[model samples]
Target: MAAELRLLLLLVCWTALASSRCEFPAIFNFGDSNSDTGGLSASFGEAVPPNGESFFHGPAGRFCDGRLVIDFIAQHSGLPYLNAYLDSVGSNFSHGANFATAGSTILRQNTTLFQSGFSPFSLDVQSWQFNQFKTRGGVAYGKGGVYRELLPKQQVFSKALYTFDIGQNDLTSGLFRNLSIDEVKAYIPDALAQFSDVVKGIYDQGGRSFWIHNTGPFGCLAYVLERLPVLASQIDQAGCATPFNELAQFFNEKLNQTVVRLRKHFPHAVFTYVDVYSVKYELISQAKKNGFGNPLRACCGHGGKYNYNMNLGCGGKKKVAGRQVLVGSSCADPWRYVNWDGVHYTQAGNKFVFDHIVDGKFSDPPRPLRLACHKHI
Candidate 1:
């Protein structure tokens, strides 16, 4: 009788693992800079100095001091490091691909920096990728290949987890250009709705489970405060603009609601909200409450006071008047800091966020909607 009971327990555990929606064959990512690996470098631009100096010690094409959160999560989930979609050299989508670009938005109007070619992760690009995977035959191998690869080795990502980290750049651009807070607020719900539609598009193309990361605390980011005068007077020390943060919270709340609604629309789909807003809030609050000093300060920055620039990047030298001058500065310790510059996070900072996601702290496990996204294999 004891042996029979033990057999029953094993069967129950196996059943639970099989039922989770995340049990996909592999992961495919979409969204913007927060998850971008090398998308920005694919485009022509003035090279920023302080980008990617921490772990790789050079511009490895990331906007951070080291690996971004997506890289870490992929590693933690026991998958190969996600390759940038444009990385012709080593990206193998036999598992999946990342089409996220730096500074991409769901809506074309939300584009911030690269205004000339301002194409949000428009349906066009997503469709293009889908088509490419179905044809290109090289690194851009077709979806048929992915399907074949997975059928045999489905266990690798039997519960494939997707990660989307975008939207900050969109909001940042409007706020920096002196747009009214109310104007930005008005656009957010529409953005969330558009973003939700994009996710659903992916689902229609064979995606099973998804983890949608809400936007971070844009108000607390140092760049926003420095760029917006009104924010300086209101909540400058916090490094985030108060109105922006509130807008972010508002958007996230609505985003969660949208995710809830999506669950009803697609009952078989497992949608999870990665609450980056709260995770970031905790990091900054802890930094401030402990007087960490330089909470708002970036670990790598050029210039002083109001005019910080990343153009000079860390450890670079510039020549002026026949003499060389250091173009940028790096913090004494990157692990202790959060903001990499006015735009990104340190490796340590991302690790902290990862801890929260895997453990399900400060919120319920499997998210409130509770779809079968991350079941054990």
Candidate 2:
């Protein structure tokens, strides 16, 4: 009788300890500028002030006025803010690290879609870097061996959350190259295949929990609205470019299908396909209710209908009416606008999306984001 009682106590204690363990002790993120904390800034010294003026008070390498969605996720999970994989100074790997870089694409060859040249850090390249990180016992190879800590301890990597928010550049680059809509659609399969390969690679390396975000409503971006005159008539009553939104919707639909296929392939893996488009579109569709006064305009940039001047770029200086002025002038009230500098979201906008994404319905596996950290526990 005493032996059985002791056994019961032991089992109860073990279960309690397992439940009490910190939820999602670590997180590994991969994507482009949308979630880049500082990789692009560390590499090229871009994203300078007033880029991060709103909240960070200085450019922290985020392509926004403040935090990215990843930052919010980290905060909610009780993990420390992620350090960019390339940042050399003041980096902490106890939680995990971010491998995202501005301009990263799903396909390596997609770089040719741009006239400036190719991006060296494709999703495949990021995957390779991740492999290197594992081989070196958590030490990152490039950017002066920025991360030196023995991270994602062999056991931690299996329980960590792996998040991905890429492929926007792939489609955008095709559009910039003037590819027909059908041609651009044709690229979806290849992009999804590469995405699958990336996830498989991570799975092979012990990662099992995933939080993936689909591309948002790119057509609603101030930059796209300014550049695509043909889409002018497609603007709806709410001021969103309908045709471009349709493109985004199509891409998201295909992406969701791909996620379904991946689920079948990795039956045991937890794949959370976050509906970024729906959340972002909701904000746009009900901007007034969200406290946003100008959902269709960018908070920065100059010399265009949407205040997005491609030639001068955001924060660039140019002669304006005799006096030299910053072409991409920041607005006095960033919170009132949804788009920032034509391409990215304002800090306020990102926060709204983060709130909805964590509400459970947006996540494919239908788990609350806060609970996702404890999923494998």
The global Cα lDDT (0 to 1) of model 1 is: 0.64
User: Candidates' lDDT values, in order?
Assistant: 0.64, 0.79
* Cα distance off (Å), candidate 1, residue 304: 2.5
TM-score computed on alpha carbons, candidate 2: 0.87
What overall lDDT, based on C-alpha atoms, would model 2 receive against the true structure? 0.79
Alpha-carbon TM-score of each model against the true structure: 0.80, 0.87
Tens digit per residue, CA lDDT, model 2, 162-217: 99998777777778778877898898899889899999999999888889999988
Superposing all C-alpha atoms, what RMSD in Å does each candidate have to the true structure? 6.7, 7.3
Per-candidate clashes, comma-separated: 18, 0
Identify the leading candidate in terms of lDDT.
Answer: 2
Given candidate 1, what's the lDDT at residue 22?
A: 38
